[model samples]
Target: MENKAINSAYQYAFIGAGNMAQAMMAGLIRQGLAPARIIASTKTVASSEKLTASFGVKAVQDNSLCLDADTIILAVKPQVLKAVLNEIDRQKLQEKLVITVIAGIPAAFYYDLIGSRLRLVRLMPNTPSLIEAGMTGAFAGENCSADDRETAKTLLQGIGQCLWVQTEQGIDYVNAISGSGPAYFYYFIQCIAKKGEALGLSYEDAETLAIQTALGTSQLCLEQSDGNPERLQSLIDQVTSKGGTTIEAIDSFKRNNLSAIVDEAIQACYDRALAIGETYTK
Candidate 1:
């Protein structure tokens, strides 16, 4: 569906102005959203002042002040989300389109805390959003209109790509893959760099090689395979010729059950996300 242009007069207010919120704020501004149309609330007066100075946005110490915005972004930590929700004037939020980047909380939890009238969109965006190369997973609540979903997608697109899922549970899967996935890749890079160091390469040189190779390989696969699993496997096979060193490494990884290890890790992440949601709802 073609996205409706976001009204320039629409005001966006972020409940928390931390790293992710700041990244989003920067992205929006870079995408031509005026700084005057954006507001942020920080925990302290000093931080609020810092944000206002740095981003040229309206910053406040009071969360209630954010209610005036047309779109409200809940960017707080999951642990503190309930407390924050409790403190806000829920009635004021009934008409506003709310988008949450907080993990592990479902729309039902918010409906209970605020009201059933709330319109919400849940997003799971990774750290790469700081660099305008992030992948975001989104889910619109039953209360949200099509325009609400489109607005959320448009806002997220400023930072990177946005993908909408069919159910809220899909957000948990997204969290496991794209959200927690960055650290997994970072860990793999570290492992490669460490092994290269042990093989007598300087740590800096090894890290550079590992990072560049990962970047190049990801770009190649994205361009050539379009994320088709069969094509991706074919790309891997291209480098894994019989009797080659690459095949030796591939055989060792397969013998070590690398795929299973990754599967288990993702399952653990998804389970933890469900547990957190359960904890909050209960």
Candidate 2:
């Protein structure tokens, strides 16, 4: 096994071949990591074969590859995490750093299950990661060294932007924001399209309009200098003409307490993530 502290070129492994795992793998592969340097595995040969075909990396049906790599990413769902962890004996990856993207699952929970002090990281990735514009939030474990964090950051950097958080509980907030955020956007788009249709817009036109509007607005926010968060209030002030349509919409949203709605949505996601880990423990 390569020393995770030192930057060995050939030291990456993924213990699950799921969606986010595949997204990260694609990001790493695109960022110039040799496919041969990374290995991935799942519970079955069929899954492994699919990953091998997709990424041209080593894929196996065993967990031993995880223990052998300098970095191991545990990508299984929270409910199946312990079984996945138990399937692989810890002595293999105990010294090797591990990164987990399971929702609502904390590293300390894994330590309690594995019964050891291991270097671990909790990662929360949004669904947009598939398109390479993801917002990923990460929090390090107690035992993770600076090198371990760099390994995690290096692995995630190419996928999108990364936010380093201070605590595992912070991952819950991440879950609410980055992890479950894309779905919320999609849901809003769907509702907007539905309303457009009800207002007599053709179905296809309404759908296209809703999708493009969201996309264009996002691009505007990203590309415009006016999108600065610190100047957000000033930006809004500039946008609102006296008694304008935008102000009417803003007043409607404020009357409905949109901020509170957004907060509750995020908190709900956080609560659910914690609940997922609780389900695993039971």
* Residues 1-282, model 2: lDDT tens digits: 222232437568888888889998897887778888788887888888888888899998878766777888888766677677777776666777888887776666778766577888888888888888899999988888887788888888767888888877788888788688888998999888999999999878999999998898677666654646766666567778877888998898899999999988888878887887676566
Name model 2 segments beyond 4 Å from true.
1-8, 223-230, 278-282
Tell me how far the alpha carbon of residue 276 in candidate 2 is from the true structure, in angstroms, after superposition: 3.3
| Candidate-wise lDDT, in order | 0.91, 0.80
lDDT of 2 at 86: 78
The global Cα lDDT (0 to 1) of model 1 is: 0.91
Q: Give the CA lDDT, 0 to 100, for residue 6 in model 1.
A: 57
Residue 71 in model 2: shift from native, Å? 0.7
Question: How much RMSD separates candidate 2 from the native structure?
Answer: 3.8
Task: Give the distance in Å from residue 9's predicted Cα in candidate 1 to where it truly belongs.
Answer: 0.7
